[model samples]
Target: MTLVKSLYAGIATASFVLAALPAAAEDDVKIVASFSILGDMVEEVVGDLATVTTIVGPDADAHVYQPSVADARAVAQADIIFVNGLGFETWSDTLISESGTEATVHVATAGITPVKVDGMTDPHAWNSLSNGVIYVTNVAAAMKEAMPEHAGEITANADAYIAELEALDAETKSKLADLPANRRTVVTAHDAFGYLADAYGLTFLAPVGIATEAEPSAKDLAVLIDQLKAEGAAALFVENITSPALVQQISEETGIVIGGRLFSDALSERGGPATSYLTMFQHNLGTLLDALAHETAS
Candidate 1:
């Protein structure tokens, strides 16, 4: 896997970027997204207008993805590429350059103000549904520009998709509204939930930092263990893209209940609970509410 580079400053994206891209010559509007979540968002907006390909597959980690020959070939043939750009896919720049492709790389998290933790930019913007709306809107706008013939259909699809997102956002807020300030503490393997916590009135804790590849030092682990024992986490969750060992260890030490698995960085397999972005969010919300709201693990 490729080690993600340092934080980037100007992570920008637009509601659209394929302004000069010619209309689909044949019916193939090939798009390459950086990861599974981004790919699913693109699919929702583009509908069947394009064939979306994801570089990082389900249950995979993008923070340390090493692009393979197959990845290069896909990018080389793609007309457009979407990435989470707040330094999320730090390996992307090298991959796109080496792919020898002229495809336009669009930053999905373009307009959303990024959240930084301990001075490092947090790249998991899609954790917030408001920002998620921006991601698909950007894809839809670019798609409309690239294929004017399907503009009407694209707009309709985007509208419906955005509505569902907004409805769910409201629902999640309502479901979590009564969670007291004290009960909003969420613990996980890494700091991937900063955006989600910010969006839903919850506080998140993790042993390591944002990138799963960065191992936590003994000092860091000790401090976190002390903190958890002191304040206590409402529930512990294991993310799909990360190893469950750290969370299990933490659970054993703290005796905090392990709330079922949460899909943080990736989706699940074809028949699994979280196969797409929407289903992933729904599953995560249900899991958290069940664990945090009711503490059902006992």
Candidate 2:
């Protein structure tokens, strides 16, 4: 009888322990970001608290990305989805609808006052370090709400990241201030740098509008050429996500040197100069400054 009782007690204890094991093991919150830059921000904010899946990857154009069935499946499984709202992702609505995800959707650019161009909102708000802070904050808030158990960790991570963004913003302003006022005008393939221009006191002119999918009309090209000549812009740049054909043509016609590639819409691949948000900003600034400084010397 004593041996039988001990065997029963051991079985009960084993069952209890098995039941408690799952409760002790925490599940990671699943998060999906619309593109690479936002994915980096989400990763920074969540640390290891969540698993981040990015749809549009490095050196890819989010403006023209089409979601696949696998992407929908990932979205459906996400606990939260972060998008860059201001009409940046044209297919985002369809993806969300098709996935029928119950996930909470957060637009990273929620509180930003967007720079408008040609009756359309420029969705590249992340180009500005200040707006990058806002993106991080919104993501952190969403993470806290989705994973309340990890709210403290999310908040701390976000605070530290925002501080770094603030420092980067200060550094950008200082660097831009070093350039001559007349030399601050920049010409690129697309008008994706409106927010950066507004934030850094530079004038950006492009032949094509915000969306790279649309080609520039001949009239638009003519007008941009005239403006470039009038503004005496000496350096032209091509974006990472755009074909350099147009800007290269412009550079040849106008005798403006082709400055190195700028990571405008998307970041470079891993181990590249503009891999992260911070590195992207630094790389762009350095590239621009170096090109313009060479022009100044000449």
For model 1, give the 10-residue run with minimal summed lDDT: 6-15
Quote each prediction's TM-score: 0.90, 0.89
Best by TM-score: 1
* Per-residue C-alpha lDDT of model 1 across residues 1-298, encoded as one tens digit per residue: 2232311111111102233345556768899999999999989888887899999999999998877666766777788899889888878998787556778888888789989987999999989999889998998888888889999999999999999999999999999999877678978898898889899989998888999999999999989989988888888999988889999999889888998899989999899999988999999999998888875332
lDDT per residue as tens, model 2, 1-298 = 5743543444445445544654323475688999999999999999987789999999999998866656766776677899999999998887776565778899999999989998999999999999999999899888887788888999999999999999989988988887877778878988899999999988888888899989988988988877776667857888899889999888867777787889988878988898889889999999988887666412
lDDT of 1: 0.85
Where model 1 places Cα greater than 4 Å from the true spot, the runs are: 1-25, 295-298
Per-model lDDT = 0.85, 0.84
Cα RMSD for candidates in order: 6.5, 11.8
Q: Give, for candidate 2, the lowest lDDT window spanning 10 residues.
A: 17-26
